[model samples]
Target: MAAILKDVMSPNPVSSNATDELTTVSKKMKEEDVGFIPVKEDDKYAGVVTDRDIVVNGLAKGSAENVQASDVMTENIVTGPPDMEVEEAARLMQEHQIKRLLVMEDKEVKGVATLGDLGVENAVETAGNVIHDVSKGNGNN
Candidate 1:
């Protein structure tokens, strides 16, 4: 199977505005069962924020409710086109040690892809032997 951004990217991923507070972002992440959310500016991609970012940059600094998502968002995002293969994306992610990738198409944000979303569906090996064994009924080995 060819790896493409469309096959992995989470379409319509949960998002927050740049002006949103860190506390608010945390709530959204919990409510949506997501570890991160994209930051947007009037429908334009701005940056991205993860749970760790909120904790380290906000709560750790005692500024959760006051800190804006933009302030702590990861601006040096490694994005990809929708047509890119999933294997290539995985390689990039591994080299950078990133868990998620912002998907872009025609210079616009289309979705986001986390390591789990891509490999889990295409190759169980992408998740390691633990997941593979679990999914395969833990055969007597």
Candidate 2:
């Protein structure tokens, strides 16, 4: 069976508003252990804010903490519906050089998918080699 984006997506990812303060956004990102957050404006997904963006743009530029999330988010985003095939997602991710994707259903936020979520474990000390190991019938990593 073809894998679906839902299988790899992180449901209900931590998100924030474009108008929210940078401090608030930082706290949410850190507390959630997420590198990115979906940004919304006028009740619609506006863009995404990434940890790198903060470091490169906000901190390096010395943007005040009072600055809004909108000021730092990357607006040019690529999104996919929940039922989108994993290959399509992978293709998109490869084409865009993105590690994550937002999953939507009926234009409503549903989940998020990241490359890490799709990776198989590599530990080799147990009764068997880790996931996706060739000996156990899982696909090669």
Candidate 3:
């Protein structure tokens, strides 16, 4: 049987308000020791802010203190159901050129699945393919 997303997802992911300043969000990322933070609005997941987004979008825009999490967050994020097969999730991540997928249920964010998590489950080949694809022309090399 194929492994499900929930079996490898990082549950109860850290989230931040959309209105939060980049400075605050950056601090939260450091405190949580995470590279990504889901952005919330009206008690629902809105988007995701990553360390790269902070540096590229927030810093490049100047005055990061005035930048909001929503300003740097990736709005059109890819997501998956908790019951999705790990292989399916890997396919989605590769198709979307992303490293993580938000696990959602009934429009509620439950957890996040990353390439590292897939590796932990011994899906190294799939994870490697995803990394290679996502890194293409993205300066990840």
Which parts of model 2 have CA positions greater than 4 angstroms off? 120-141
Of the two candidates 1 and 3, the one with more favorable TM-score, higher being better, is 3
In terms of lDDT, the best-performing candidate is: 3
Model 1's TM-score against the true structure: 0.79
TM-score of each: 0.79, 0.79, 0.86
List, residue by residue over 1-141, the lDDT tens digit for candidate 2: 978888878999878998987788889988999878998899998888877667656787676576788988888877888888887776665455565777888778888886555442321222132322423433211
Give the C-alpha lDDT of model 3: 0.82
TM-score of 2: 0.79
Model 3, span 1-141: residue lDDT tens: 988999999999889999999999999989988888899998988889988888877899877978999988988788999999988887777677677888999998899998777654556775666567745644221
Error of 1 at 135 (Å): 27
With a 3 Å backbone cut-off (N, CA, C), the pairs that clash in candidate 1 are: 3-85, 3-86, 4-86
**Candidate 1 lDDT for residue 109:** 74
**Model 1 CA lDDT for position 129:** 50
Q: After superposition, how far is residue 82 of candidate 1 from its true place, in Å?
A: 0.9
lDDT of each: 0.75, 0.72, 0.82
